[model samples]
Structure formats: C-alpha cells, structure tokens
Target: MADSVTADPAAPSATRPTGDPLLVLSGVNKHFGSLHVLRDIDLTVHRGEVVVVIGPSGSGKSTLCRTINRLETIDSGTITIDGEPIPAEGRALARLRADVGMVFQSFNLFAHKTVLENVTLGQVKAKKVKPAQARTTAMELLERVGVANQAEKYPAQLSGGQQQRVAIARALAMKPKALLFDEPTSALDPEMINEVLDVMVGLARDGMTMVVVTHEMGFARRAAQRVVFMDAGQVVEEADPETFFTAPRSERARDFLSKILTH
Candidate 1:
C-alpha cells in the first residue's frame, strides 16, 4: 500500500494556521523562447502554511517553485520573500537564496564530499560559521531527517533515499524561513519515496512554511493547508484539500484530478 498523509492535531489545517506572508508571487510571467511557461501567476505562502501546487507536466509548477529562490528569472511580475523583492544579482541574491531553501527532484549532492561535508559547507562558507559549529548544526539536521548515521559516507555510497535526506538536511542547515520542493519524489524509487515524504511530513508538523510542486496526491491531500491547481501556466483552482479532492470547483481541476486519481 502507498504511504498515507492524514491530518492530525499537528497538521496545518487542524491548527488553522495563518501568519505573515513568506512568499508572494504576483502577475508572474515567464517565457522560454516563444513558449509561454508561466502566465499571470499569483500565489502566496504564509508562514507555517503548506501550499501544494499540483498540475500535469509542463504546466509551470516547477518553474513557479524555481522562481521563488530566483533560480529562474521572470520576464514580468513581482516575487517577494518576507515582503522584500528578490535582488537581481549580487550578495543580496545569495543572501536571499540562503534565506529560502530549495530541494529539487534530483538529490544534487556533491559526489566528492561526504554527507556531513555537503551539509556543513554552505554554513562554513556562506554564513561564515566555524567548521566545528557548522558540523554541529549539520549533525542535528541530519539526525532530524533520519540520516545522521550516513554522514561519514560520500553521496555515491548512500542509497537514493539517504542522499535525498541529506539534501534536505543541507537545506535545513541554512535555517531557511521557507522551503521549496520541486517534484521532490519524482526521481525516487517506489520504496524510497515514503522515507523522504516522512521527513517532509515532520517538517510540516513542526511549522515549516513550504511550497511544494508534486504529483503526490496523498501528501497534498493530507499535508497541505491549500491546494493550487495549474494548467497551461495559469492557476485554475485553489481550495482546501477536502473540497479540492471531493468537489473541485473548476472543470480543469476536476478533469485533472479524474485523470490522476483513476490511475
């Protein structure tokens, strides 16, 4: 059976989570050559809220997540984290990235570095922390994500799930206020997906504001406070999980869910 993501007292919705907006995207548009990838996108993720973005392939879900950390630039619109617009380039952009962590579909670990090294490098280099202090924080995060025992091994020595957990640990080492996940489980083996999802679930329970782009309906339905459906680069619907899963208001969302749930 697949892993379940059911709400409990610790879930965002259960607590009626609301707070200062952490990430805001307004009138966001992006074009790759003649292809319009993102169109008039408007979305917000508040502190301690989990907003899951679900859509079919090529619907701009991944691009939207990437834009939050400025990994992908936009042709128009405004994106702000903690109410400040992202800087074009420089130390400001780097600091902005440090403030918002991102995990991609691929593990993206350094092949040459040990798991511990990978987690601590950013803190030591970017945050100007001492090596010992960085390692301490890295170990805590590694332990938090259930991968501390794998710290001495290089990325290639660990299983895919272990590597991904380490990636999550690396992100958390930055102490980012919000995290973005783009298809976090898409590249995982069937058995490994749950381990990563378990880590994510714990983060949600601990009040980590998150924006996730994924097709994992169970996680979205059970973990997210709101679900946003996108199609052809436009947001088609947004609703609480129960309503979105049972009685989606938009035809596009209904059609999309029908195709997804039937399989």
Candidate 2:
C-alpha cells in the first residue's frame, strides 16, 4: 500500500514510546568557531516514526540531521541510538554508522561505478558480505527504489531524481535501523522532485524510521507524523503536521509558514 498520512490530520498522535527510543538527543550543541549552529537541541525519534524538520536557511535544520549520525559532532549533550551512547571513534563509530544510513543532497555516488556497484560496494567492503550475496541484496534494493532497470548505468547517465533514488537504495543496502535525508530533493528539478519523494513515501510506508530535512511542505504534510520547526539554531516549535501548518504557536513558525506557503 502507498504511504499515507494518518486520517483526520487534526487527531493527535503522541510520540510513540513502544520501547526505548531508537534515537535520542539531549542538550545537543554545536559551534563553528564563533558561530553557534545548534543550540541546546533535544529530540527523540521512536521506531516507525517519520519526522520532518523545516525552517528558513541557516536555521540549523541540516546540522541537526547531521548530528544524529555524528557526521557533525556536538560540543555538548549526549546522543544515543538504540540505547547505546554514540562512540567517539574507531570500530565503535563505524558500527554506529552502519546502523544509521544517511542520504545527502548530492548523490555522492562514485563517478566510475555502475549503479549496481554503488549499492553493493559498502555492503561488500564495510559489512564484509560475500560478493554474490551483496549483488542479490543490491538488486532487491534497486527494485525497491524503482530503478532496477538502470542498475548498469553510471551516476552521470541518470537524471537527478534517478541518481538520488540510487543513493537511497545504496543507503538501504546497509540495512540501517533508521534513515536520515539531508535535503534529498533540493538539487532536483521541479519535475523530478516528486519522483524522489515517491520513493521516500514508499520507505515511510514500509515503516522505516526517518528524519528528513527539506522544504517540501506537501511531503511534510502527507508523510510526516511530526513536524519540527527550527529557527536561529533552536527548535522553536514542534507539532503534528496539521497543527504545525494550521495553528503554529510560535510567531517564528507562523512567519516561516507564511513566507514559504504563499510562494
């Protein structure tokens, strides 16, 4: 079945705590020399939840997403995934990264590798899966993302949407417990945005816990269970998608929605 927003958008759905949170952050802070990029951030992502983070440029939305996987380190605060504290480095960090998959705005595929190779490379190298096993898994993921037909093509040969879908497939091949999308559709042409979004929609429907950083309001409304609004390096407000769009409590959130939704 296609992924869908819960019926009755106004109905509240509390953050599910079926067990321990799959991802958690508390008092997270990050600074770039004199610039404070993230300020006292706290977030919890439960299993099977889809949370979309949205805000103006320089609002720290992307930085927030990066910290979850330790792509960017926090100066303070603790982050834990599946009840384990984030490791500082070495094999522990590598294992943590394997459990969390990240897709960047850039497709970041090896220019020389075929789409199939791009998906299988990490599985074979990092996870130490056998080549034949990795190939079968790669083909299954490519089919899942709707790009099995283009498996033999290089990144340069595919459209931006197709390349991003391959990127998603590559991340999924790792069999991560959660996925993070950093503006996955920002680089795509308008016509291609929906194609990438559709693949993401499918992943959400299949119960992949996801945190997406994007300006795609329609996807945010339709797929996200919770909408987080950030401003000036702080989480200004967070609410269910319907309430966030229709009845934002903070003036900053209201102004942001006005500027984006009107245009």
Candidate 3:
C-alpha cells in the first residue's frame, strides 16, 4: 500500500528490528512433474529486513516466492509467517494471504475496475471496512504512489507502470505484515521499470519487510540488506550486498556475477 508508506498502518507483531523471524522456510521442496523446482530450501527473513533473491531464469526463484503465500503449494517443508504456519485451506489461508501482500511480474489489477475501486476493493470486501474509510485510505495510497490523478481510470487506460503502481496500492490496502515481489519489473518497458523500482525502494527505506525475487542487480545492491543467490533450485549463496557484489565466496556466485556484470 505504500506509495510512500512512511506511516505504517500497524506495527509488526513484535519489533525484531533485525533478528525476529517474520518469515521462515525450512527444508522447503517442490516439484513440477519431474522437474524439482525447489530443493531443501531453508531461509529466514527477519522483521523489517529486505532480502533480494537473484538467479537466472527457471532457477525457481519465482516458485520460491509463490510458495510463501501458498499460491504454489510445496510437496514438503514448512513456511511460517509471524510465528504461525500458513493455514492449510479455507478462510484461514485467505486471512494469511491478507497478511502477506504480493506483487507479481504482471500487474494483476482488476481491469474492469477504476484504479480507486481496485485499490479499495480488498479492504472493503475482505476486511469489511466501510466504503468511505476504504476510499479515503485508497486515495491516500494512490496519491502517494503518484497515480492519484488516474484513480478513476481503468487499468487499460494507464501505462504499464501506472497499473503496477495501482496494484501495489491495492496490496498496501490490506496492511500486510510482509510483502513478496516476484520479478515485479520484468514485464515493464525499460523506461517504465524505474518508476516501479523507485516505489519499491521507498517501501524498503520505510521499514517494510519484503522478500523480492528480481534480476535487477542495482535494486538488489542498493535496497537489500542481504542478497540470496539461487541456482538449480537451491540457495547457493547468501551474503550482504557488498560481499555478494565484490567478494563473493562461492564459485557459483562468482560465475553468476561475472555473467551479470559483463553485460
């Protein structure tokens, strides 16, 4: 919901600052037919920490992000958010999703709804907030995202970047505990990419806990407190941004960096 969610709607369940595990994945595994997309994944994302996951395409980074919210279920392993394992199904799972906001590679906005309605719908429908209150919050978010002027327009009428911003505003309307991004900028035109990345950077700076899967090294290097490198469906390296970018300890990481940096 942050265009500049400088003002949080609610505090973390507990302020871990840099240690409390807001999201934990243990021995997480998944498969798509014969393809093992995730393999014994174990990771922890602390409260208010931003972790960026980077890897070549088909490395299962996107699948890993999807598993957090149960959009893609795992064959084995455990994932917990805010100290609670994700609900198996029904209203409980829905409620858990409300707590974990997600932004996708494609701007998954309601194409039929106006930008304002798109942003406010989740708050009113899922959370049962009054329409007026939801609208006020929606407008505030849209304004902060720099798309308030286009609030009345349909998704088709706005540029790709604007639609994505509206999608972010919609996610923020829920005031989730953590946000997951699955290559959010991959679909945008080159010129429109930064507008969305800038919004993400602002969210990180404002203490939003986020787990991002992206190929944008600059964004990862600049915003992430830790960088995770995934390869062949496994986490091969995890390090601070500087260590990852400059003195990578893993040969796999160094090769990956060489390939990425040579471009």
Candidate 4:
C-alpha cells in the first residue's frame, strides 16, 4: 500500500533539500463505499510552512487532515510525508504517526490521570523515554504552553482552555516534525478560544510546521503562510491571507467568505 505520486519525475524527495516539498498529496481520493469524501486532492506543504485549510461542512476538511495520519484510508491516490510514502499498517505506519502529532477539537486528555501523567504516557510508551527524562520534557512543554501550573490537575478539574493547552503540551511532548490541528478551537466557548489561539500563535511564532483546519479567519490571517479553500472535496483556491480574504479568485471561495465573515 506504499506508493508515491510526484509532480515531476525529477522532483526531489518530499521533505528533503531537493526542494520537492515536505508533504504531497496527488490525485488523492477517499470513498466510503460510493460516497467520495475527497477527490483528486493535490497539495504540497514545505518545511517551516503553515497552511490553513477551510471549507464548508462535509467539504472533507477534517477527513483530509485525518488522512495525513492514515486515520482514514484513501481508496485511491497517494500521500507522502517527509518523502516517505504512508504504508497501510504496521511499524512503518506507527512511525509515521509518531512523526506527525494531531490535536483534535475535543481536548482528548485522560480524565483520570494528572496532566503530567497524560503527557508522559505517550513518550514513555511510544518513544521509550525514561520516566525522569520524560517528566522533565513534559514539564518544559507544559510551561511552554503556559500550563505548567496545572500539571497536577485532571482534565475534569481544568477549564476547557486549560485542558486544550495541556493537550497541546502533550502533543508537543512527542516532538513531532509537523502538527495537524483539526478545528482546534471549534469546541471552545467564545471567551476561551483566544487562550488556545494564543498558544497556537506562539507555536507559529516559533516556526512550527503546522496544518490547521479551522474557520478562525483571524488566526488564519495572522498565522498561516498559505490559506487553502476546499469545496466539494476539491481545493477551489489557494492564496496568501491578504489575497485570500480580500480578493479571493473563486466564486465558491468568495461566497464562503461572505457568509462566514458576515456572521
């Protein structure tokens, strides 16, 4: 199930100095029986780049993010990460997942474990990091996310913003090369969204390679180097923030922006 589809035969390996791209999706198609969730998805993300994806519901935004980690299988086409083609299952897939950290809308934390323990588990299990070393790393990441004070608290005891920060720290503890956020702020209350966004803004400031699927136009404008607009399982437009927001070229993109910004 490992395959690659490069834009050019002489193209360099994705994620290499050959300038191929950090990630590439070519003619990527996903189907659940007859329902096509993604169609002919062609995209390239380079190192140290942030790309924001936006689309209407069912436009395959979340599905596309999940596909990067093989959380969902593609029925056709290929996806490459750092020049490595994603395998269907087993050790190679596990390694790929480890290299790519994902943050979900729901703060997927262990409610029963302390925040420190939640962050430590993955490092200990997946990375085989020593307990003491893992704890030190976890604390540093927690501090980075501005949640070091909440390390002893359980998810149930923390506010939504705090919980999400902890989740971000946990993801960073894995030292992933790239982070995928599937609507990271979608589940937060209006007042709490900024806190999470602030942490993400800091990450962007540090030049983390990130792909965020969010409708937060403000964050997209402020943080993303490229904004990709998808419609009907296809990318209708791709542009910088200023161009995408002020002068989108596609009719669907303009319409989508009008509706979202109006409200």
**Higher-TM-score candidate among 3 and 4?**
3
lDDT by residue (tens digit), candidate 4, 1-263: 01112123233321222233777888999987788889899888877778899989999999999999999999889899998999889988997898888999998998789999999999999999999999999999999888899888888999888888999988888899889999999999999999999999889888788899999988987888877888878877777777778977777888888999886
Rank list by lDDT: 2, 1, 3, 4
List the candidates' TM-scores in order: 0.93, 0.93, 0.92, 0.91
Model 4 accuracy (lDDT, Cα): 0.85
Q: Which stretches of candidate 1 lie over 4 Å from their true place?
A: 1-17
RMSD, one per candidate, in order = 5.7, 5.5, 7.5, 5.2
Best by lDDT: 2
Candidate 3 lDDT score at position 187: 93
- C-alpha local distance difference test of each model: 0.88, 0.88, 0.87, 0.85
Deviation of model 3 at 36, angstroms: 0.9
Question: 99-213, model 3: which lDDT tens digit per residue?
Answer: 9999999988997899999999999989999999999999999998999999889999999999889889899999999999999999999999999999999999999999999
Clashing pairs in 4: none
Error of 2 at 60 (Å): 0.6
Off by over 4 Å in 2: 1-19
Query: Over the full model, what C-alpha lDDT does candidate 3 score relative to the true structure?
Result: 0.87
1-263 per-residue lDDT for model 2 (tens digits):
12112223234453433334789989999999999999888888889889999989999999999999898999999999999999997888998898999999998988999999999999998999999999999999999888999999999999999999999999999999999999999999999999999999988888899999998988987788888888888888777788888888777888888998785
How far is 41's C-alpha from truth in model 4 (Å)? 0.2
